[model samples]
Target: MTRKEQTRLQVLNGVLEHQVTVDEAAQVLGLSERHLWRILAAYRKEGAAALAHGNRGRRPANAIPLGLRDRVVALTQKRYQGINHTHLTELLAEREGVVLSRPTVRRILVRAGLTSPRHRRPPQHRCRRQRMPQEGMLLQLDGSHHLWLEDRGPWLTLLLAVDDATGTAPYALFQDQEDTRGYLSLLQGVIERRGVPMAVYTDGHAVFQSRRAGRDETNRGGATQWSRALGELGVTQILAHSPEAKGRVERANGTFQDRLVSELRLAGASTLAEANQVLGDFLPRFNQRFGVPAAQPESAYRPMDSELDLGSVLCIKELRRVAKDNTVQYHGRSLQLFPSMERTSYAGARVEVQERLDGRLLVRHREQILTPQEAPALAADLRAQVAEGPVVVARPDPDPTDWNPPQRVKTPVIPGPLAGDSIWYEDPARKQVHRDLVLAGMERARYQGKRIGRPRVSERPEFEQQFTVVVERIGRGGLSRRQAARELGIGYATLKRLLDSQEKSCTKPATSLSLKPDTGEDY
Candidate 1:
């Protein structure tokens, strides 16, 4: 039995024993005397059994069936375990055929050991303030930084403006950081969507508020660039003392960080584009649940001014007229601005020259936006003539046959079987032999072009072969390997191997007839 019923039984017991008066028992238990007397009578008639209420055995008429309760719990555990009971309940009815209240889902979850863990914290202090009656009367603008893409990407700053009355987010955009450009672009979007609001509430960001000066102490009489733009459109800008002062957007940021992050995660929004697409559908549902009604029945937003030039107001530089000579000077460059159509004259005339944020030039005079026109052929020719400097001509070279190469002299060679052996010849004409023999001797002489005298005989292969054997013996006999290898162009090991192989072959004995050395006279 519940504590209340137990206490009622105890009060009845006190009344039955006559230990306390009915009025006293009733007063002690905070109940009517008649109610206490009724409890006492039921206890006297049915003993302790009557102390139980009649409704104890009665089942609730609208109670869900056990099977249905089990099914709902199973569905929640299987498909929506981590989802909140309220959202789960909605999903249950929508996705499945289960119709259950949020409280019923919560009860089922609790009984099934699925209650959400509660965090312990001290009591929070809250401030109470009334919002404006009309939706467009006040807009709270701020930026929130979060890991909007989970682990998929870097953190992004969300620049959002929420209506103070309806809590409706009319403008939201993702940026790399909260900067002046972000707010300027955000304001432009808000203006385009909902027209001009009555007033805007924001923190003291330099974009909306003057840092060096207060709202009433700016260079142009307390007006910032954004403030000036708003003033030009007759919109009021209210600067908040702190983040809490503009509590609407601040609180909205908190809600979005929690609910929106989950929403984005569930929708598989890994990029800014995907998040924006999902946000379009999520904002309406979120506003319906948390938003309050506006105080005024109608909106207070004003129509945008017709003659207001949006680009010029948003951009940093002021518009100026383009000078003649088809040129509009800015910063340092002398920009040449030409008219597309055939105009008789543009001298001493007003032409709007828009200096863009990225330092680009756009000239607009009257209602038409002027463009450059191509110069005529005659004008181009005149410009070329008036320009300075003389032209130089480059011609091709004369015929190749006109040039002659240097002459070269022929040399003669020695004769005999030794012709094959590379030998140096002193006078080639004197050593001339049979044409074929001379050719063969010429090959042996190893005639290298353009030498003053005969090349050293030691350069010949026959000289190197005999010199190598002698050098190897000299090395083992006394001299260093470097002296021996240098004469043969072979390393120490190669010379040593040659000597070893010669000794091995000599000891192996002669298998063929030995020939006598040539005794022919020198050629």
Candidate 2:
């Protein structure tokens, strides 16, 4: 029985004993004296047992059967094991046609040892803070870097915008990294969904904050491209001094990184698209659990500025003038503009030019917009004639034997002492051996001639004599190892072996190379 019903029975017991006056009992019970006396007379005539409620013995007509309850518990244990109570309840209702409230199903599963493991919640601290009065009044924008796809792919950044009051995720997208382009797209989506919010609260990321030019400047100045774009749309950009200043978006990012990862896994989302689709369905349910009513009824979102040019503002490019023939050149593509009857010359006039991310041309000359069209065959012929020059061929063909190998310049090799500097022997044969060895080593290092030495390392003075001959032969462009070996009149494998040994011994770190100023591409 309820506490009020139990108190009423105690009062009736006091009345039956006549220990307290009916007027005093009425005052204690907070009831009228007339009603208390009437109830006491009725109880005295009917006896104490008759005062019990008539509906106490009746069972609820909609009560679930014990057998069905046991079946649900068994199903939960067998099929829906490890699932959360809400999900388990859904699965039971959908798959087994056994509908039960989440709490009832949870109790049954717990009794049957089918309960999921309990997670320890962090300690809560009460603080005085106010959320926006309505949804769309303020939006918390942030990017979260997460391993959304587990080890299946590289890390991705989930850019999200959450409504401050209702916890509604109006916009969310996945990108490889957090960049200005990603935020532009997210902002575009937000504007499209619920119009412009009163203000956007975000951390002091470089993308949001303008860098100060000097120390004397009190205000954060030098408007960034992003800030300028937002300014044109009349959206106030608020930079938070600390993360706690923009706690809503920061906290939302944390919650999503934890719960959204699990949600995506449960939904079997492997790609960004699939994860986004599941997020659409998961956000409303998430909000219902966490959201609170706003302080006021109406939203503060203003209508989007009609004069805003979204495309031109979001893209990065400079304006250029079209030539006399109504054509602009960018990235080697000639964007031609056709003249209308009202216009005469198109020379020296500023036009809106945008290079889209996908490398498309959008040329706007006043209200007249023009896309590039392929020139007519006649026009193409004239242009080709004006642009092209004649090609020249050189005389060729020299006799095979007459093609003598280039003269091999013999250079001196400084040999190491055979036994601790005791003798400095000048053996040309040994020098030749070392030279052959070094060349053969270079050949192997160059991937068997698949990739030539791109000069990633500087020429070591220790191998100056050996490298000079090799560099000369390679610079000539037609000399081959076989020819070099033939010129030296040494066995091919012996020369190759010596070269390989020299390479193995001369392994130096790449940092050893000297960084010189660029002098064309001669080096």
Candidate 3:
């Protein structure tokens, strides 16, 4: 009998002998006197055997069969290789029609000495920061580039946002890459659905923060397009120093990588659109299952102002100067800004050119939207064709010579008769002063050891005398060109050049032998 049964039997024996009262035995066994009386009756008739539990030696009613457990282990080792225990449990229920909890499946595998493909890391102590008291106070934004469609489709990046307060995903989408435009669209969706968040927590991705590789953190440098968009919407952006700093989104990425990939595979989502559809269906359930209510009921998210347009706020914005032809060139495309009611032309005006999420180019000046037609190919020539006003031929000053072009001639320095009405002569005093200033500037530059002009061609190198002696030796048949090159610490080409130059300077006969017959090939 089990120790618990043996103790109960001893207490009942004491009660029967009158040494232990009914109340005392009941208290010892932690049972009511009515139940104790029933136990006493059974023990008096059946002896110590009645103390054992009735179902102690019987198998549980819901016990899994050996065949099913073996099948699961075989699948884990073969078909479902590399699948985690938790994911395998779900797949078993959905596909294999073998319903089981993760721990039950894990138990079967552990008994079979089979382990999960991925191992859990030992938990480390970390000081987790408390979540924001209200939703929309802080939302973690991140993008994960992973094999969402496995081998069936191209790799895609999933842009995700998780609320710090509720641990719920507000909006997520798939993109070809993690780009400035993708994050902007993500923020736009979140804002439209749940209102504008007070702030965002993100990593130091180039989309979120301006690159300052060699600069100090104290120097923020400048706002990136994403940061600028947030600023325009009055949303504060907090850059995380490490993954743990933004653990909410980082851990969400890991969970999606594990579960979402399996979901996409199970749904047979082979295309981006199909994957997104599956994702859309999955997120609501995910939020419902995992989301918790915030500590406070009131939402921290500020209501979007009716006047503030999300399309204008959440997009890539750049300062573009309107070309003289009233156009803004962006990414090899010309955005032609037409005249607004207040202005006749945007030419020479610095305007904000926004590439909206819908791929529309918006040019705004002083918050006024300017719509312009897409100038066709060779737009510059087209603008030149459409003149703003009348074509006026620039003519000379209104006079007798207005019909004739004025002729210009220079007067002689010696006061000759070459001067004309439109002619002008150089001033001698001004020229002298300029000359003096230039000379003084050159002297100052020379004193500062700054080179004044193109490097002077060396008339003669300092070692020319020594090189000349070596060349003469080679010419006199005393030293070979190779020998002379090594002795003078110069190359064979240099020695040969010296020999040729010496022959020309001294008018001496050539004494060096021709090294090789010309191949007659152009170098």
Candidate 4:
């Protein structure tokens, strides 16, 4: 017997010998006197064998059969090899007519040395933040691109919005990829279904923010397209510094990839439309199963304002100048603006072109909505009216034979190549000219060498002329050479050279004159 049975047998033997009372034995075993008496009677009859449970060695009536276990294992290893435990359990019940609970299926598979395909890592340590007190206070939005349709369809990005308070996914949409338009449509749908959220928690995606971060964004393309949309709606945008900070939505992404992918496989959804349909049908059930009530009863969502027009607010707007012919060209499509009552024509005026989600191009001058008609393309007509080549006409009798060969001069003279030009030194006249030029350059270099190029201010005649007057002023002991240099807009070295070039000019910025460290630099 095990330790518990051994203990019970030891206690009961003492009670049978009358060495211990039934009350003490019951208290020691944490049992009542009546139950202890029954155990004592059975122990007296069967000795140590009665200490064990009667059904310990017997098979349970509701136990799963060995045959069913074998068949489940066989099917798991054959048909559902790579499926997770929960999904395999579901598949077995639906496809194989096997009525087994998930735990039973997991037990059978694990006993047969089969493990679940999905391997989850251990959780890491992080600061856990509390959820919002009420719904609509904050919404965590993110995009997860995965094989949601597996190999049946193309890869799609699921733009999901999860409410922070209740952990409910308010809205989600399948997109070709995570783009600004997809996010715009997502935010628009959320604003229509649920009211405007107080703030949004999301990652630092390009759609939600600009790449030129922490700088003057106004000059650098301002904000991103989605950021502008959020600003128009007056919603606060919160950027998550790391994935762990937004773990709720990130974990939701992981959960959906695991469960939703299997659900799509079960529904046989092979196209984007079919996948969306399945997701729509699954969202209600998912919310009911997973969503929880918030800490606060009242919602924090601000109700939609009746005056706010969602179409104009949530759209890609572009500023286009109206053409002189009363047309606004957007993406090569000419939108001809009709004259409204306020103005005769929109030509020479600026207008905003809003590209609505429903593929409608709206031209607006601030608040006035102008009617626009698409001008037909002129490419085909222009191509059809093209001339094949320049119009041809016979040359006017070739100028009546200027080939009369100008009998005055039949052979025109042409200058021959200067083949002997490289031998210029051999020419006595050219050599004398070059010699004189070299001698003249050497004489100038020797005579007025300091005045050849632009000279320093010291070498200038005016600086030398003003030297005596500056020295007389500095001799009064008020101004320094550095101060004089500053007032005259010249370097200290230039001023000192100008002073030293004259006779007995020693009020200079030199080491001999620098009696103290502050000597010629005093103001």
Candidate 5:
């Protein structure tokens, strides 16, 4: 019996035995005198059983039938095995016509042990930075490498930017890899659609900064290519020293890995373009579901500067000095700058060559775009075409009788006993005699100090082989040189020197592990 039922039985017994007054029973039970009287009368006739609820063991008239419940569970196990309870509920309503709320589905699945809450590690205690007061105040940017298309296609990288204040993803695109051009395309999309953010938070990749370990801070003060582009647009770039510092974007990447991958699979997206098209349709629904309102209703984003040229601001720019003939060299292509009205000649002047995102080149002089033509190659180089230009010399015919060459002399040898009258035939005894004679001569020459042939790697000291193993292991495992040296019983400085030499000897990169800047397509 419930505690309420037991309490009522006690109250009625107290009143019937005259141990407690009727007024006291009513006050204790928080019921009126008249209501308590009715209950006491029923209790006296019906006994303790009357205190129980009348509908306790009965199903309601509106309850779903047993067959429907069984079908729902069976369908979940068969067709939508991995679907979560909430998504399954929607699918059941739409496809199976079994209307149910998420909580009801969750309770049914939990009873069957088909689903359970996810287990997560306890969060570390750290002071969290508060979100900005307004949207667009700070934007966290990152790229996630994931198998977004599942097995239908190759792995792709999703470049995204999330507004820190509102938790809204303003820009995201599917690309072949995480590269400068991809970031540029993302930046352009954001600027054209959502306006300029006040500041961007990112990690210290080579695309954002120079990553020279031994160089002083002052030496790396000059802006990188991407940084310079951002500076030209008046956007502040904030570099994060650790992953925890950029927690917003990092968490977004994790969430995308979970939700976006499933969405792409459901959409049957098999290529980058197909994934992007699906993403375009998915972002709006996602933002609507996950975006939070900022403290202030007003947005913090500023309007783009009218004079800014996005084409010039979002490209690879390199400074080249013009030669006396008005030629500038860039990536082995010589571009001849034409004279404009502002200047008679650009000879000996430094000009900027911009490689636009669309793979077009533009030469800019004093903030002015110039027409560039391919320069004619010089005559001194044989690689330059000379068929239509000039002939250096005339061909002369040679007389065969006038050409005298050196005469050859032949020496004859008498055939040996096993010669078989063939030049290739040789006796085994004679070969063995020649080998013994060479060995004897070498033994005699040893006293005079002589060595031949290259040394074998295995012949080196044992310590050197260990050093090589430790170095290669460190490179693969990403261990520090000091830690590796300590474990291998070697000096730290010696191991460091060996690593430096190995890096110098490697013309190509050992692995795609370093945060190097990527120069490729924007899409």
Candidate 6:
């Protein structure tokens, strides 16, 4: 007898001999007291054999007949060869007139060895993260590149965003490629429909994180246009370190690759637009099937701010400084900003140019939208076409008598300009002052029969003193003293002492900071 049958027999015998109460026997056998009484009667009538299940050795009433099972196995090997259980189940019902559930078909095939049971490696234990308590707290975002239309069309990428709390997909779109405009369009739809999510979890793609090396976090800020738009909208973007880190979206991609591809295939969608139209019908059904309710009934999504201009925020923003001709250049295209109330001239002013998702360009300054027209292809001629006002042109060749060519003259100086005087210096202000001093020194030295040439850098006390002053000024302006020292060609300790003395003299009491040597004397 089986272990369960042996245990039942032991419990029944114990109750019969009075060694255990009926309640105790029922508890040990995990059966109700009423059920135990019936078993007790049966046990007394038929002995220990009564404890065996009645249907243990009998065929199930609902089981498929052996003949049907054999036919299914044969068809699986012949007609429906290589099809999966689910697919075979579909074909059997539709083509062969054999209506059987997927599990039933799988069992029949497995028993006949026509198909082996699917084997998988043991899953490694991972601590699964819990979903956010409220909807819209976090949305896992990703893109799945697959042949969504199967053999009917080209491969496409589905830009997807799934809410963490509810497992609801707020947005998904089929795009030719995963580009910035697709994401911008996706976000625009999401904000208009379900409001903006608090945060988005995405992978470390170039769209989210900077791929360029050597840029600090600050310099790398808003490196990608998508990220810049997100920053403007005040939405936090969290980039996952690995694919498994965003397992929700990664697993969702797998599901879409399996189910969405099939749905698109069945719908006979071959183009991007046709597939997107099918998604509208598919998403609602998908959510109904897979979406779960959030832990909290209240949504975490804050109502859209009244001042939130989604059109302005969900776009590609590029900072362009207006050229001297009152024009802004972006992506090889020059745009001329018309005169507005905000300013008559945009020349030399920074204006934000937004390449809207709809493929229109908008020029904005201080939240004021400026009317921009594509400047003529001849960018050099934009100033004359549309600028602050009407252009006043002088004839290319004016009357010879009216426009006389000016004459050039020379101004004499005490000494000719020095080589060091004309050379570009990092500190122009210091360079000018030193140049004047050198000229004056040269004038005075001529009287002493001394040569007028560049001073030796190491021996020039004035140059060293001037450099120290420049370094000290830079240090006071927030540059680290060591960095200032490196730029100024001085020792780090020397710069530190100079800065310390200057700071102490300026902010604190004018007291000397003396250092004590090992001999107990102040240096």
- Which runs of model 5 end up more than 4 angstroms from their true locations? 1-83, 86-99, 111-113, 116-119, 213-221, 342-345, 373-523
Q: List the candidates' TM-scores in order.
A: 0.50, 0.49, 0.60, 0.60, 0.59, 0.55
Superposing all C-alpha atoms, what RMSD in Å does each candidate have to the true structure? 21.3, 18.8, 20.0, 20.1, 22.6, 22.2
Residue-wise C-alpha lDDT for candidate 6, range 1-523, written one tens digit per residue: 9988888888887887899999988888888999999999998999877888788789999988889988899888876665567766876897789999999998888877766333445999999898899999998988888877767888899999888988878888889998888888888778877887889998887777767643534324536777777777778989899898888878778767766765676677999899999988878877887899999999877667887777887787767789887889888787988888768888888778887777889998877888699776664354324432332333243222322333322322222133333222133333444465556666667878875653333444454456556654774786766667567555666555655665656554322323211221211
Flag regions of model 2 displaced more than 4 Å: 1-127, 210-222, 305-317, 321-334, 340-346, 355-360, 365-523
lDDT, residue 352, candidate 5? 84
Candidate-wise lDDT, in order: 0.68, 0.66, 0.78, 0.77, 0.76, 0.74
Question: What is candidate 1's TM-score against the reference?
Answer: 0.50
Candidate 2 minimal-lDDT segment of 10 residues: 511-520
Report the C-alpha lDDT of model 1 over 1-523, residue by residue, as the tens digit. 7787788788777777888888999898887878777777888898877877788888899888999988987876775655667767776886787887888888988999887433335978977788888989999999998888778766888899999988888878877889766777787777888888998898887788776664342236555667766777677888899787888899889778766776776677887778777777877777787888888879887777788776665554334555556555555455555545756556666665554444455666677666543333345455444332223233233222322322223333332233354323443322332333435444544544433334434344465445546654785786666677666444566555555655666654222212222222221
- Give stretches of model 4 more than 4 Å off: 1-57, 67-83, 86-102, 212-221, 379-381, 384-523
What is candidate 6's TM-score against the reference?
0.55
Candidate 3 segments exceeding 4 Å error: 1-62, 74-81, 90-97, 212-221, 377-523
- Residue 27, candidate 2: how far off, in angstroms? 38
Full candidate order by lDDT, most accurate first: 3, 4, 5, 6, 1, 2
Candidate 1 Cα misplacement greater than 4 A, ranges: 1-83, 110-127, 212-224, 311-336, 339-523
Task: Name the better of 4 and 5 by lDDT.
Answer: 4
lDDT comparing candidate 5 with the true structure: 0.76
- Measured by lDDT, the strongest candidate is 3
lDDT of 3 by residue, 273-316 (tens): 99999999989977986899999989988888898888988877
Error of 2 at 254 (Å): 2.7
